[model samples]
Target: MAQDESLRDLYDGCYRRLVAQLYAICGNLGEAEDAVQEAFVRAVEKPRRFAQVDNPEAWLRTVALNVVRRRFRRLTRYRGLLRTAAASTPADAVPGLSPDHVTLVAALRQLPLEQREAITLHHIVDLPVREVALQLGVPEGTVKARLARGRARLAPLVREFAEDVEEVDHV
Candidate 1:
């Protein structure tokens, strides 16, 4: 496909999904959207190179994930100021994610970066383990291991979230 067509198709196929995937990883909707958009921009800048890649969606996801991670690391360098700013920012100023969703996102944030990425790619983005392996440049077995470890870590958090929901239902 031509460059323009490929970009259009990529936007159509992966834009929203990538944003959601990034949100799942980053726990910040604005950051997630920005990361995915930046990834798309980078992909467009190297259309020919990207076109030759085997799995474009995975490529985009990896790029977006890197962007988010880089942004987080940069922000962490100014952690004090960033935390103050984040605290002062109204909840409504942020995108409208539900409380439960926010809790789940916080749980994701508690995991190690690789574990979170592996879980997001496999579960949130619905990518196969092999594809996630390709995206992260790891072996499939590594992806499997990360997924297992991540799930084990997350299981209690998920159960807690579920219990919260059940309690709310009883109210």
Candidate 2:
């Protein structure tokens, strides 16, 4: 198959799953989708290598993950500076999404960085421990430790949201 056509087929086959996995990492639907899409755009620049890859899905995923990781690292470093410099617009107030999504992203943002990445990769993204460790370039035990800590910290935050939901339902 011509490289371009092959890449198109791979994109058609993999886009949805990639976005879902990325959504776990990014905590925002638009970001997840956009990151995956952009990865493919970059892939087109090297269609020959992309076509020669044994597992296009894995290659695409690694590319997408790298993209997200770079962005995460950049944002982590910039978050405080941006907070001070940027406008104080509320995400929920921006419209087009439920308040719950905005709240969830807010809570996710408050998590310790390692914990957030571990939980999202291991749980929400549905990667097994070995894969998570591989993707994170960490020891398997480290991934486990991060997941444990992340879950423990997240429990109270998620519970608070759940309690709010229950109260609303009962009202």
Candidate 3:
């Protein structure tokens, strides 16, 4: 009973923030919510272990991030095997997100998963490079390289977006 109550409190406090973080990482709201929810469910399945954690929220975030990564890997494999099958796209943009936000996320989806993770954590989530490295379990130099590569890939897309905005303003 106590474990359940504490877990409930943690969920109420961290759910939205985790979802937003994961959404930025994954570029899809539904997948983000599902990942976070899966993390909580895992906590419920191992209450004693969860209670032993010193930083429950961080632990939850790690679990959710792992869930997202695993799903992406599995999906990639599935897609590779189904190359001849029709590709499905997300049905619509998330409501309440701006057009620029949508465009940026679409561009982000083009990045390799590692680079996308680094860029999202460092830039979108505003974590320091050291912290991003820690979260990703990569060396600082690797994180730096990923960030550089991601930025290089995104530069043209962002410049095009800016040009479109400028043209719209001029008209």
Candidate 4:
């Protein structure tokens, strides 16, 4: 296939899934969309030696994962600056999130990054364990382990939230 056709095919096939994957990792729709777009740009800039790869979907997933990771790292480093900038300017501030959403996000933030990534990819994005393993470049067992542990950790947090709600109801 010609380069344009190949790129088009890759984009059509992978864009939605890649965006979904990134969203699961980042927990922010806008950031996920941006990361996927950046990944596509990078892929187009230097076409992968596609002839050597058996599964292009897997390759695209790997690239997308790397893009998200890099973006996350960059965001971490500049978070202070970003916070300061946001504080100084009310123009771009996002509206407040629901308390339930905020609580869930805070719980997710407490998870180890790998466990959180695996849980989100599996539960939120509905990706199969095998596909998530491939995307994360880990063994299937590792993905399973992470998912199990993450769920175990989250269960109590959710229960605690529920208990707090019940207590509030009685007060």
Best by TM-score: 3
Worst 10 residues of 4 by lDDT: 85-94
Please give the lDDT score for candidate 3: 0.86
The 10-residue segment of model 3 with minimum total lDDT is 84-93
49-162: candidate 2 lDDT, tens digit per residue: 766777777677778878887887787678777676534345466356567656665566567767777787777667899988887789999999998888888778878988
Reference-based lDDT, residue 80, model 4: 67
Residues 1-171 of candidate 3: C-alpha lDDT, one tens digit per residue: 887899999999999888877887788899999999999999999999999999888788889999999999888888789886434355245887777777787778778888888888888778899988888889999999999999999899889878988999999
Which lDDT value does model 1 have at 156? 97
lDDT of each: 0.83, 0.75, 0.86, 0.73
Q: Over 4 Å off in model 2, which ranges?
A: 79-106
Ranking by lDDT: 3, 1, 2, 4
lDDT of 4 by residue, 1-171 (tens): 597798798888878777766655666667767877776676676776754567766666667667778877786679866775322222113245466655565566567778878987888668799988987889999999999999999888878887988999999
TM-score of each: 0.80, 0.77, 0.87, 0.64
Model 3 / residue 155 / CA error / Å: 2.0
Instruction: List residue ranges in candidate 3 displaced over 4 A.
Output: 84-92
Please report the TM-score between candidate 4 and the true structure: 0.64
lDDT against true structure, model 1: 0.83
